[model samples]
Target: LLIMFFTTGSFADKIGPTDGNIVGRETDTVTLKFSYETSNEYILLYWYKQDTKSTPQFLLYKSARSANSERKPTDTRLESTTTRDSTELTIRGLKLSDSALYHCALR
Candidate 1:
C-alpha cells in the first residue's frame, strides 16, 4: 500500500509499505512494521485497519515528539510506536476477524 505523507510547505509524497500481510493466531499479539525515510521535519504517524473491502478504519496516531497518541472509538486493542526510521502497530488479543488489510499513514 502507498502511504501519502505531507512534506514541507504543503507538498505530499507517497511512501510504500514494508510488506504485505502479518500472520497471527487467536489471542496472540502481532506487530505490523513500516519502514520509511523522512527528512528533519515534524511528522504525524497514523495506523488503520481495513476489513475485506471496507474503508480503512482509524486506529491511532502520534507525533514525532509527543508520546501521547489518539485512537478511534472502535480501536480498543491498537497501539502505535515509532523509531528513527520505522513505525510499528501492535495489536493485542488477535481474533479471526482481525484478518484484514492494515495501513499506515504519515504526515
Candidate 2:
C-alpha cells in the first residue's frame, strides 16, 4: 500500500500526506496520517475512500473544539482524531477490499 498524496497548490507545508507504504492485515488496523500547521486557524478535515466498485465514501469529519467525528452511516469502523497541529484517520477491522486510494482533504 503505497502512500498517496492528497493536496493541491497550497502554501508551503500547510498540508501533506506522509510518504511511505501502509500495510495491514484484514481485521487489523491502519492509519492514514496527515500533518498540518494551521497557525491556530480552524479547518475541517475529511478522510475519503474510493475504490474500483464504489463512489467516494465519506468516512469521517473533524473540526475545531469538536470532541467527536461526524461520520456517515454512523459507522464505528472509521474515525478521525485531531490535536493542536496534526490529525489521523484510523480504520479498525480492516478488510481485503478496503485497500484502495485514499485522500485527506482539508477545508
Candidate 3:
C-alpha cells in the first residue's frame, strides 16, 4: 500500500510543510514536518488528514514556546513533537487507509 500527503497553511505567516507529496508504505512509520515563524510567546500547532471525498480530520495539536505546553492526539498511533520553529507528526504502523492529504497549521 502507498500513502500520499500534502500540506496547507498561510503564506503570509510563513507556516506550512517542509515537504510535499510524501509517500509511505504499509507498516511503515512516516513523519510529516512543518515549520512556522512567530514572535508571540506561545503558539498552537495543528495537524489534520483528509481522504478523498471527505473533509480533513483533526489528528492532534501541540503548543510551542512554552514550558507549560499541552498536546493531544486523536489516535494512539499519532504523535507530535514540537519546537519553537518546527513540528513533526509521526504515524506508526501505517495502513492503506492512511492515504490522504495531511495539513498543518500554526496559530
Candidate 4:
C-alpha cells in the first residue's frame, strides 16, 4: 500500500499592528489586521501568543471560507472582523496572551 499527501501554496501578510507597538492599558482593547493569499483553497485563520519556548499556544480565533460553515465564537477577550474577500482579525480586551507575533495561515 502507498500513501500520499497533498499541499497547497498559501501565505499571510500582517496588514496592521506590524509596528509591534501596542499603545493601550490592560483594560483597553487592541486590534490587529492580517491578509492571506491561497490557491483558491479553503483558508483558516488563527491567533496565538508566544510562550517561553519558540511555539505559540492556543487558538484565539478562527474562520472558514464558507458562509454556511459555523463561525468560531470570539473569546470575551478577543473578537474578529472579516470582509467579503479578505480576512481581518480584531482582538479585544488586550491581554498578555494577545501580545505576540500574530499570524494568518491558509490551509
Top TM-score prediction, candidate number: 3
Candidate 2 Cα outliers beyond 4 Å, as residue runs: 1-5, 8-13, 53-55, 65-73
What is the clash count for each candidate, in the order shown?
0, 0, 0, 0
lDDT of 1: 0.64
Off by over 4 Å in 3: 1-12
Model 1 lDDT per residue over 40-62, tens place? 45677787667766888777776
The order by descending TM-score is: 3, 2, 1, 4
lDDT of 3 by residue, 1-107 (tens): 44445555555566767876668788899888888887775677878888889988888778888744656775788889988889898889989888888888777
Candidate 2, 1-104: lDDT as tens digits: 33344653246437777655587888888887787766546567777777767766776678744344455426678778777666787878888777877767
Model 3 earns a TM-score of 0.85
lDDT tens readout by residue for model 4, 1-107: 11111122243422223334445556565565545444443445555545445565444545546532324544655566655345555556556544455454444
TM-score of each: 0.73, 0.75, 0.85, 0.58
Scored by lDDT, the top model is 3
Candidate 4 regions exceeding 4 Å error are 1-21, 67-74
Query: How far is 80's C-alpha from truth in model 4 (Å)?
Result: 1.8
The Cα local distance difference test for each model comes to: 0.64, 0.68, 0.78, 0.47
**Which of 3 and 4 is ahead in lDDT?**
3
